[model samples]
Target: MKYGVYLRPKPERAISGDAYTIREAEGSVLLGLADGLGSGEEAARASRLAVACIEEHASLPLVEILQRCHFALRNTRGVVLGLLRVDLQAGQVRYAGVGNIGIYALTREPFHPISYNGIVGYRLPRVHEFVAPYHPGDLFVLYSDGVNGAFHGNEALLRTEEDPQEIAGTIARLYGRPDDDVSVLVAR
Candidate 1:
């Protein structure tokens, strides 16, 4: 799979409160994005903790992984997180998320997967896992709430962009808010 990531902090902040992880293990690709409850150091810590949990438990089931993240983040500021596991051998994608993180599938049949409303550590709603077939040329985009959700309208750019890095950079540059931490991850 080809993938790219872009991350930036609010203009006045020294570090972004957003964190992400991409890992390949046991015929699957694990992708995760976390936005801490707010910006700056504490938020960054929360997000980092979430991503670390994901990396440490990449082999677990989606729900289990998230559950671990929830337990691990209890003392922190909490975070909104999105997790996707692309099962290459099974030709399917399994995803679970909580809060405003957006996951967009730009494939022959495009669709947006739903995320439950809640924060990971503070108040987690019942988790639901969404599954979708993975095609050869499918593109998956995940971003934090700091990114403008309306950017999905640029399907042409998303579909045709050769470099995944360019796609991620463009989206963050055009749609990301300067007052919040921004993160975008693109994988195909």
Candidate 2:
């Protein structure tokens, strides 16, 4: 399977504490987005550590990765994380999230956001899982909490186009607030 990824990290409130990464491997895509507690260098560090944890175990199961991160961040400031694992050949999408992660599968119609609860490194232990729908031309989009008030871009462009970076940039550029850090991932 082939894919594209685009990301733009910004420091909105003079602190800028968000980090993300999207990796496409042999059979799956490892996508992670995190918001480190508050703002400042500490926040950035938390976000970075969260993403690094996910990348380190990119080969593991979704639950295993989440569990590892949960343990690793126990002593840190913690972060809100969204993890997506896509099986290209199996035609499946797996979601395990803690905190503000807006995820969707856009086809001809847009659906409700996936149910996510808890905060990594925080006291919230709510962990939920969902199986996302994967279609031939369906686009999967995920964003951080800073993207709460995004413009969302054109569903048409997302469906007709295959470039995830452009789509992510368009969404970030148009929707991201000046006082916010926007990180996005688009997959089809």
Candidate 3:
């Protein structure tokens, strides 16, 4: 798998309220992105906690991992999280998300996966996991709301970019909002 990640804080802040994790485990590649409730230090803390929870429970089902994050972040500002598991051996990708995080798949039959509403630690709705076939050259992008959703319109860039890192950087640079923390993760 090839993947890249980019993160940036709000213009005036020294810390970002978004965090992401990518790990290869048990024949699957785990990808996660979390955005804390608000900006600044407390927000950053919540997002970090969410990512840590995902890492600790990397072996669990996607819904269960988010549940664990809910429990782990109850005392903090809470967060919005998105999780994706690419099972290379199984040739499928499974995803679960809460709140505004975005997940886009670039493949022969591309589609947008749905994310449920609510905050992770504060008010989680029933979690729904989506599974889709994974092809060898398929690419997936997950981004925080801080990046404009319209960036997805640039299918040419997403398809033509050779390096995942450059795709991530280009998306953030062009669509990131200065008023909010931004994060983008690209995987192929």
**Per-candidate TM vs. native?**
0.97, 0.83, 0.97
Model 2 gets an lDDT of 0.71
* Range of the 10 consecutive residues with the lowest summed lDDT in candidate 2: 1-10
lDDT of 3: 0.91
Per-residue lDDT over 61-83 for candidate 2, one digit per residue giving the tens place of the 0 to 100 score: 87677788888888889888877
Provide C-alpha RMSD values for all models, in order: 1.0, 2.8, 1.0
Model 3 regions more than 4 Å off: none
Cα TM-score of candidate 3: 0.97
Q: Which candidate's lDDT is highest?
A: 3
Clashes of each: 0, 0, 0
Query: Could you tell me the lDDT of residue 110 within candidate 3?
Result: 52
Candidate 2's C-alpha runs over 4 A off are 1-15, 108-115, 149-153
Error of 1 at 35 (Å): 0.4
lDDT of model 2 at residue 34? 80
Worst 10 residues of 1 by lDDT: 105-114
Q: For residues 69-150, could you state the per-residue lDDT of candidate 1 as single tens digits?
A: 9999999999999999999999888889999999988865545588899998899889979888887788899999999988
- State, as a TM-score between 0 and 1, how close model 2 is to the true structure: 0.83
Candidate 3 residues 84-124, lDDT tens each?
99999999899999999988888765556888999999999
